[model samples]
Target: MARFLGRRLLVAIPVLFGVVVLVFLILRLIPGDPAQIVLMGTNASPERVAQVRHQMGLDQSWFSQFVIYVGGLLRGDLGYSYISHGTVAAQIGSRLPSTIDLAAAALAVALIVGVPTGIIGGFWPGSIGDKLATGFSVLGLAVPYFWLAQLLILLFAVDLRWLPALGVGGPTALILPALSLGLGFAAIITRILRSALIDVYQQPYIIVARSKGLSNWHVLTRHALRNATSSVTTIIGLQIGNLLAGAVATEVIFGRPGIGNYLVSQIQLKDIPSIQGIVLFIALCYIVINILVDVSHGMLDPRVRKAWAS
Candidate 1:
């Protein structure tokens, strides 16, 4: 297991490097000079423009600038934001907590809502419970997140005055954003969990459990659930990436302050450093989540550990 983890970590470094390179080059490809954008808002002289460009390292050759950025990254400095005029690491650090909080809450809701629906539906396939669960899952999958957020705002915020339209206040503030994010993930989880449950139920041990006069709940919670956890864990691990991406859209729609909101504003202002920082932070989050997923596979299933050991 330790060897497998070491190999995974070894592989992740190059993947992260590739993601950084791709994201950096793609941002550069987009036609807009960050210095020019900054100058457009001010009555700056040519010297001033040159100064801003020099400070941002835009006056340097692209290769030179790339080297500087790579060097700074290696030293754990994300660089200064060209627009905000602040350290990229500090700016991201401030907003990251909120995004993480929101994403974690949404994923928790997805798991809580999705797993039960799937288990019940799969345990009694084609029953009324199954149909209801499937229908709800369809609704979740079909609804667009932004549209749902807006509708929620209208119904709960405007019409009924039950919750704030935007900006988190309390537990109530979480409901709308969580719902907006969770519904889609819940649908995905439901499909994955249902399939896994179906497969687990077909195993001979399940039949033995049934024949041994075990209650349905006991069999499910113990025998079937143990075997099914790895699949559900895999789905959850994969969805961490989606959750992070969705946070940007959700934060914008809900008027919440998070890394996504900060990113959108920075992109509009053509803050190259901020853009690079945000993408890098997101990439790091993805890599870390994947690592967690790998560890979870071994933790949730001894068979996986045994296979790795072999």
Candidate 2:
């Protein structure tokens, strides 16, 4: 396991380096100068604009700026925001918790709902309950998150008066946004787990367990669930990435103070450092999640473990 983890980390280095280059270039490729955008409403002179550019290190060549950024990143300094005049690290640090909390909550909802529905569907592949679960999954996937969010808000917040429309008030405040963000993930997980579990149920060991007088629930839960988790784990890691990306829209719609909202606001203000820092941080998270997934796959599947051992 140690060697496998070490190898994964080693392989991730180049990917992360590529991400650093790609994110920096992509942000610069977008039209509009950060300095100009930052000074948009100001009556600043050319010198003032020049000063802002200089302070932002924008006057430097792209390669030079890249070098500076890479150096700063190595030193754990994500640079200062051109617009906010605050350290980029500080800005992201403030917003990171909100995004993490929201993502975690959404993932929790997905697991809570997805796993059981999947188990039942696998247990009874063509029954009314299975059909209903499949139908719900289809609905969850087909609907746009923003549209779904508004519908949920309308139903629960406006009409029913069951929950607040926005803000981080408490657990109630979490329902609307979490549902909007998590439903699709829940659907995906359910479908995948249903299929995987069905395959596992048809295996020889499952038959043996049943022949040995094991009840349906025990056979499914103890033996089948353990084997089915590999696929589910993969889906979970992927959904985490989706959740991060989707949270941007969900945060805005629900008026939450998260990394996604912070990124959106900074982009409009052309806070390049903040944008770059946050994006890089997100990319890092994605890479780390995938790595963890790879590690988990190895742990759960002996074939993968043996391959890694080789």
Candidate 3:
């Protein structure tokens, strides 16, 4: 396991490097100057603009900027926002917890709803329950996050008066946004798990377990579910990235103060450092989640473990 983890980290280094390069280059390429945007109402002279650019290190060559950025990263610095004159790391740190709370709640919702529905559908393929699950998955996939968020707000907050429609406060405020962001992913989890369970149920080991006079519930819970862990884990890990992406729209619609909301605001303000920092942070998260999934896969599946061992 140590060897496998070491290898995964080694592989992730290059991927993270590439992400940093892409984020830096892409943000630079976007139209509009950060300095100009920052000094929008000041009517600053060209010399003033030049001074701002120089201070912000925008006057430096791209390569030099990249090197400085990389160097700062080595020192755990994500640079300062051009607009706010605050460290990107500090800004992100303040906002990241809200995003994490939203994402974690959404994941919890997805797992609680998706896993059981999927198992049931797998247990009774072609039955009415299975059909219903499949139909729900399709609907979930088709519904846009913003539209769903509004609908949830309308139903629970407006009409039913059961929850608040906007802003973050307590657990109740989290419910609607989490549902809107998570249900779509729940659909994906349902489809993947249902298919994987179906395949696993038909495997020889499952048949052997059944032939040993095991109950259907026992066969499913003990044999089939264990075998299906790898596939389920993979989907869950992949969906984490989707959850983060969806959070952006969901946070905007719901007025949640997550990283997603912070990111959108920064984009509008053309805060290049903040945008780049946020993108890099998200990319790092993705890479780390993938590594965890790989490790979990190896742990859950004997075949994967064997391959890794070799």
Clashes of each: 0, 0, 0
TM-score of each: 0.94, 0.94, 0.95
lDDT of 1 by residue, 194-231 (tens): 77888999999999999999999999999888778788
Report lDDT (Cα) of residue 272, candidate 3: 76
Model 3 Cα lDDT, one tens digit per residue, 105-178: 99999999898888888889999999999998899899997899999888999899999988989999999999
Which candidate has the highest lDDT of all? 3
CA lDDT scores, all candidates in order: 0.85, 0.87, 0.88
TM-score of 1: 0.94
Is 2 or 3 the stronger prediction by lDDT?
3
Better of 2 and 3 by TM-score: 3
Ranking by lDDT: 3, 2, 1
Q: Model 3, which residues run further than 4 Å from truth?
A: 31-34
RMSD (Å) per prediction = 1.8, 1.6, 1.5
TM-score-sorted candidate list, best first: 3, 2, 1
